[model samples]
Target chain A: MNDSAIDQKPQTNSIISGAQLLIHLLEEQGVTHVAGIPGGANLPMYDALTSSSIKHVLARHEQGAGFIAQGMARVSGEAHVCFASSGPGATNLVTAVADAKMDSIPLIAITGQVSQTMIGTDAFQEIDTFGLMLPITKHNWLVRSAEELLEVIPHAFEVALSGRPGPVSIDIPKDVQNELINFRPKSIDSTDVKAPCSALDENDIREMLAIIKNAHKPILMIGGGIIYSDACDDLKVFAETLDIPAVQTFMGLGVLSNEHPLSLGMLGMHGAPFTNLVLEECDLVVGLGVRFDDRATGKVSDFCPRAKFVHVDIDRSEIDKVISSMYSIHADVGDVLRAANNSLQHVTRPLWRQRIEKLKESHPLRLDGDDDLFRPYGAIKTIASMVDDSANITTDVGQHQMWVAQAYPFTRPRQWISSGGLGTMGFGLPTAIGMALAQPDITTLCFSGDGSFMMNIQELATLAEENLNVKVIILNNNHLGLVRQQQTLFYKKNLSAVKFQQGVDFAMAAKSMGVNGMNLGQVDNPHKQLTKALREPGPWVIDIPISETEMVFPMVAPGGSNRDMIHGEEQ
Target chain B: MSNENQSLLKLIVNNHPGVLSHICGLFARRSYNLEGVMIRPIAGSSSHKSCVWLLVNEVEKLPQLIRQTEKLIDVITVEQHDMKESIFEKTEQFFI
Candidate 1:
């Protein structure tokens, strides 16, 4: 059937199977694409999808599908859906869903369960998906009947998108999918179903302003919430108007342009010496849309010990989860920032700014060998120079990821995408595919280490088939660099199990998967080859080799205060 | 059974298959101590709603835990009451 023929078919007040109804409901929610692979359980939903307009991208694994959905949702700032079968398929999606939950990305995972009657009978492809997803999701549902899809589908989107946006899951039994029912299709507007934000307290804004007025050395600590709530513009204005420097958490990297004078790069564990030092001296810490994660707040008690912290987040539970706040505002961070911006005075502590400038000059982030393209920092900077600010950058969890975070000059919100809270190694490739799928006009760069790349290397086939404008640059070090670094620094140099004895040739592997591959190691002029590969790209994997001895520096020992950072040269 | 160290929490929540699990799961995952729990449908009220009364310790984390519980989709309202007002106190004789 063609598009017009499907459009002509009667959609409302007609008898349809539960699976068909689910497709129609998803269509109503404005979902355009879904990523998943059909299996024994979820085949019915896939079968129904053939008649609908939704395009399904078949992922090599359920984990890839979940991360693909995450990529779309993380970039678009809306809830995107992924599907999976029961048992192993559902289990495979756990990591991605948990990653989404940790990062507060809005995602929906729908899984097919065994027939309702055979739930506890140990039937084929059976698992308690509802129970598995309960702890990870914002909310979840196990559909008992076809009729419940009407309420569950919309509520799933609502729960996933509302408040502190996070992943949600739905488990549909096979019997429910096959169950026939008369569905009166109502035009459910996606906007209408969104829950309204609670009214912000005026007094909270008043108190925030009063605190800002008294503090001599104040710093604005921002996070992903600023990007999610679309408060980046407000934050910029507020920080500039007050002449206060702002420090970003890992997830909040692109909220302020890296070149912004008030922008003090990322703070906490892997933060620059100046950024962490400035945070240490601050008399007041205004945390906006930040959860104060341990990675960003090493030794919670000792972090900003002199600062009176004020936290603003949409979720109240996060206010005192790690560090107690002097004042907590439970509302959208955008709402709080907008309110504070209105009443906040134009004040500047020139003395404090001078102090911060002095620290920046004295203890700067050392970028050794940054002029050489083969080096980590140099490779990242060269890549950033190749792509415009519009391009999206993603990285797998390792030293390569930290290198990208440190060197990539991000200018706009939502430009930097990575697994911050969960630090999943295989997140880079699939997420870049999703980003490319959502916004095909711009380039999507996936910077992965050899260890991290091998984890989801199978997704290269999906990338080749989709023909997305994604460039995968594997910084092949032939070892788990971060783990090796730790072993070298802390564990008496007994480097065991961190190195791959025999490395797989990534360039040849990419070619076998039908993607264009280039190995910089084999080329005489790697810079020229890299330039050519990045310029002409549908899907290309460029293997760039770096030494394993390179480590992400300015590190804080686990459980140590951020102020006492272990420098690279010290090791 | 009423003691200074304990507090009673009264929660009005949606009576559903997963609502109880959602509440109990929060307690278990967050490591909040739950001494006792009593739940039943409200008399002469809508069948879809139920009242759950819980006896819990750790008064310092009570306020934070209450906020977390309220964030659950099924939980409607959570109210803190003194141990003297505990519903479990009156029914202690039956269990004993």
Candidate 2:
């Protein structure tokens, strides 16, 4: 497996192929696995991979390989690598790459192009992969020469894993991989990225200190930015020190331990009623590394109207894009949180804590009335109870997505992954696939809605094809629950195309896809089914048919204040 | 939606070819700007509606606008809704 014979770099010694450098570079970057299919143009790279220590997973399709890499990233919270030959192979990886772009997963997709001589002449399998992937990736480059391959291969990995992680591509010409080069591993020096001197400048820190010291009621809204910036430890320390209630964004579900008294559950459309109520009353709102998306804000103007906003994020563009902030800081979440922790005084928002406690006591997350447990809320609670603190959970977008965010008690940061920016439909299944592929040893869960499941249900075949051990929990409500809920609240009793005429047999579908599937009902004993499915040999899907009329309650009316949640209509 | 102060129109269609383009081009060709538009799968129904709420300073042109849109082959019906005051009402419920 040693390709050291190809490592000769002396000009007179021998002309080594560039593909040899690619293989060595991947190895140097700690790549232990590559998911791809070899083709004529990529034969050299494939040969190198086969002879190297890195194991190769032959995906059924190019897109499946990309999804596998994405799954790897989701599970390991690290860069996952994939490879494909040019033309159709490169194009096929687009959807998964786009998915990665939307959800900010770090993936390295290496594409093989025709030899340099045939690149411009439209040879078979020739493709302008760099041009094709430009709009979708964080950065993309084509290896023009064998020497360039050395720089681009490792750089692609670095860029993919750095700064709010995203997909990056390196297109290598066939001839380049065949060329030889001497390889040397060196640490990347990034002086250009100057660290912020402190979480806040003296003036802003003083102002924030004054606000926290003087305020009797303050709440902290944490977002995925904390996870992205690796600020969980600092955030936990700061929250505990100040005794501030930290409410998480849907993407920030596991940022704070769910059991913490000051940890308010997710706050938004599907947020805990108590969290929204407390947000409405807080005198000060310190948002950490979270974008105030419309879903989180409900109605932008009415969001936290009574609260004075202090926003901190690495990306300044997100600070005032939705809600105006009385004070703002643009820095890394970890850096800012660390600085804040250092400067934070002996001040506790006791009144705020009391008020939040009272809100929690007043309106907990619950299904309407003494209704039987046909609700997804109880199911979500049960799942959360069963999953460990570090379980990697992905969810499909919809009412169920919000419900998972609100109900699940996450104990570790970045333990949850769901579509956030684009609210993409098919994100759950593929993302779960990626997570499972990434963390082969850990248990990964994909919670999806029947409506959302249909969006990318085809990936179940890919799941089976890859023999990935991931579990899926389908919240089958037989409707586009979120849209249905919105229409119910505003569309004057007009519910169209939102109902399912016939029941969905997910177990049948799973079996057909060559995987294990189980259907669970409220009346049926699910403990055995749950344990068996969780311990199953391969991918498992649990179909839980929740009531079709079920609605995610504690909803803040559009453009209404967070406190203005319209409870179920009076009978 | 109401009968008075109409500003919104729900145009049902057979989900046929060129329907979306025809409706959009009709609006563009007529120089009419839409306030908002929402299209979703009709519940329990096998049809799609391009529900549009138009904002205009000239109320007299509303009827002609609807008439023109209804002439499309795919459009089954055009129902104008009372959306003048409902603009803020609908917006206040979600995106605002």
Candidate 3:
């Protein structure tokens, strides 16, 4: 990509319609496929796609199309594209677009709008596309003319995939798509469309290094931003070199390998009792790319109460948002980690490692040693052993998501995809399909809950027909497990609308839709059964029954301190 | 204003088509409510650039919100002012 925005227009403009120009720009961006649909306003663009090499995968719903784009972005770490028509089509794509926004997925969402003349006339298939999309996109445009497309199209991709990437929308009017104009393939002013984080002040790094040298008991907190900035390698070298105990936030799971001596798994409300206890005792915390979110820090004031912080984040806003810090570095995690490592010397902390080992042994994450008929925890552990560490694991929201995070062993970044920020249910199947489609060399496993699966279960058709090598594991608990646990814990165990009294035969449903399905119930050999099903060709849905009474433990009560957690012993 | 009234955020952004929506979307995702908005092209400019003033209800996260606004790619400068000082009061007289 050029350094700045493409500013110079073509020396000589060639006549072309906006629809044709849009196609040419897509070709320029090296787009292989798009999740989209055709409608009245967007038909011209759809027609253009027919002749173009960019394959369009027709989605059953606009939301599904949006999610497909999200899934692709998550796997490829590149800007993906999705399209929908005006009015209801654009409305349908809203959830997916919003999801992309919260998770920082890079996507270009194009919607067809009514012709410019009919924009405000209350004509058929007309709505305020630009206004509706304003609050849901990273940036959006109402393309008034074909001439504007020359600048807007390239700029849209640059904005979507640049620093702190997110979804951008372009609401193209039908008239703009249909209008013919002299297409200028000239250099447009390409300004840097990203505000890069300021570099860490050298003095700040030295001071942080001093803090590291001084503290006897310190921990490294890994967050999702590290993964986004590709600082995993740098973080590993730094943490391992200094022998610091490292704990990952939900999004930071693979910054350090699960088996590493420094790795302390995930920390937060649903964190291990031992991990939380370690946080309570630490003297200093070096948080890299993590926001110290409420879920991660139970009560804001009580998190690492005595610990001084050396916070590093690309976004300056996240630096002091939750916990006040002794020092804050408003720079990209990679740059800061690289610079900090140079200033520090290798020093081992045997005493700190001993303390962590004791903590880990005292409050182990799982009690079960093997997979059984009912424990999702054991099942995850078994799956961890069966699949390679590099396999892509995508999860839906709820108990299963936590189970995978806690039980499975992740060794690298970009292998774990979940709706962390928005916690959107029904993200599993379609996301898995999209991710697997993007990278066919590896198998993708979608861990889903019954409640979450039903939210967008129609995507099962997409999974079945596409023949993507995805393994769908349904931890069927017959209830909204996490929500039920929350109500039980806080609201006097009143089981409200959380139960699914009449559960559908998920295996049968999946089988009918052209994929292999197996319902392993009350099985004595669950590991063997699961492994056999996963080995089958194409996509397969494996439904494993779980107990409704089972609840994830070590949960810190809302607004309560990290130490104020409710463990299994308390229950 | 007791830190609860609508505050005007003036942003000087590169005249990119996507700048305005990006600012709005960031606030929306955070569930931050906006009161009003106005966008105008800067005069005497060959560069395609514009100024946007958004009136959003002040909350506890005002500082964080302003910092995020500054991070948007096209946004060059961000200024915050009391709603009482907003030109909306002056402009409303002409329209209403």
Candidate 4:
């Protein structure tokens, strides 16, 4: 089968058993690898995989399998596959499915089920996998027969990778997998699908470009969608050509290089103080492939109160779902931005640059220079300076996540991976493993906090087994710092359920899991030790003691607008 | 969602098996309850499609839901009807 003629009607049944057909389809899709675990229910597919050319990675846990597939998808922009069995295997996949939905990553999750006869009889390992996945998945199907596999499997891929990309699940009963079916490849067109970059109305684009051209202070806000559409380079060119300073959401970190003169790093609650202030002063914001998430926009109404929004998103729903876009374009962001750069005339905004320069000088990411304790900012800065700009960073959710976004200078798309929207804790280690497996040539770093690191600490064994080059950097504050900070600030210093009463030695914990650990807690110079961890190869956990008192600053208090940031004077 | 705020939402979608699940699941995830649902397959269409009517609360999040619902792969078009224009109201009259 030539790659160019995938749509051609197959002359004959190029498949045998249902499981074999599934493998054939995967091969046809050019799937290099699949990450999953084998169980009693899905043994048929696993058996087929054994005889097939497709490489199967046996993950320690179903959740880990999901994230590994996520790593592959996030990096390559390809719809990757993961497998799980019924009951527990299916249940464990929920978190990752939700995470994919929140981040809009393209993933196809195939789970096994009880035999068709015992589907509702409460048989062994039987669970409503389809029902459980419905909410988290973009779409799902329970294949009743082997004959349906031919249609459902290909349709799943189309749904997962199309429009605003997300996860799609297909639950196949055990008997269905084993059932032999004779079928010819019917040229069923890939679901009434819309093209990726749809044509935009010329008048709409003209109106948007006019607003952008007239604005004195125009800012470009980029998001994960830009990366999904492979528009980072185009976005950078448009920003540079028009002299528009660009700010990004955490997911949008690498859309423009951090060193780019116009790049203002991240914006929102945990965003840079200077960037937030710049947004406040700007007259217009050109949002490309970005949703105005509350985390990025502070209080929805008060966020950039003076600026008129010109939003460009592939999904029509995101256009005015949050902030009302005075001017909006419905098309792929890369296409729109490329056209905008070509069609619109360039204008210099010298006054806007001066204001931004002053803002950056006055309110840089704050760190007390004299404090010698292992603050997150200092440690992150040291790692950033030590590692090459090409290194990929994954993180778990907490204060550490915010600090990583604030401190690390990421310069490429898909280089920054974290559980952004879902904010799933314990995402760092396993996700890092998946990322390393996807691209072994580049060093992958996992930035985690003590609290978040403990969520999926079981994956340390998996890391050791694979011996992948993933450096686990943990900020051991001996407390849930983010929760404690909120308690102290908003709850009148009433801290509860935030302390790690019996301190678990992370180094010893990692060693017990058969992985080497290095403690930078008591060290005078941590950067040199970290340098060794980066180059030492394989998985090494570097645990550094940080202060629970050091809160991630420039925080917009809960229910507060971005403008109402709890900053220097208030602190 | 408020008790007095009933919104009659209508959508035209391809008659795909999982399309209903996608729309309903979206609302379920947001914890928004649907008051009622009615779907009727369009007859004699070149591409088999259906018209669906959902009764929900007209809240601030309704617009977002509408947008999301309209974005589903199977959905062709979506329209909103106030109390007077509601098909649910007409159906209620039919039952009465």
Mark the regions of model 3 whose C-alpha exceeds 4 Å error after superposition. Answer: A1-14, A368-370, A522-529, A569-571, B1-10, B14-43, B48-62, B79-96
- The lDDT for every candidate, in the order shown, is 0.89, 0.74, 0.83, 0.83
The alpha-carbon interface RMSD of model 3 comes to 3.0
lDDT at A193, model 2: 28
Task: Write model 2 residue lDDT over A372-413, tens digit each, in one string.
Answer: 334677777677666666677888889888777766777887
Top candidate when judged by DockQ against the true structure: 4
**Candidate 2, residue A263: CA error in Å?**
1.2
Q: What TM-score would every model get versus the actual structure? A: 0.97, 0.75, 0.90, 0.92
- Please report how far candidate 3 places residue A215 from its true position, in Å: 2.3
Per-residue alpha-carbon lDDT of candidate 4 for residues A451-561, written as tens digits (9 for 90 to 100): 999888888887888788888899888898899999988999999999989887888999999888978966566667778878877888999887788888889887688
**Number of the top candidate by lDDT?**
1
lDDT at residue A349 of model 1 (Cα atoms): 79
Off by over 4 Å in 2: A1-15, A37-43, A61-63, A114-128, A178-207, A368-374, A461-468, A493-504, A521-525, A557-561, A569-571, B1-96
Which pairs clash inside model 1? none
Worst 10 residues of 1 chain A by lDDT: A1-10
Cα lDDT of model 4 by residue, B1-96, tens digit: 224677878889978767788788878876776988889898787778899999987577787788778666678888987667466766775555
Question: What are the TM values for chain B, all candidates?
Answer: 0.93, 0.69, 0.83, 0.82
DockQ values of all predictions: 0.55, 0.01, 0.47, 0.57
Order of candidate numbers by DockQ, starting with the best? 4, 1, 3, 2
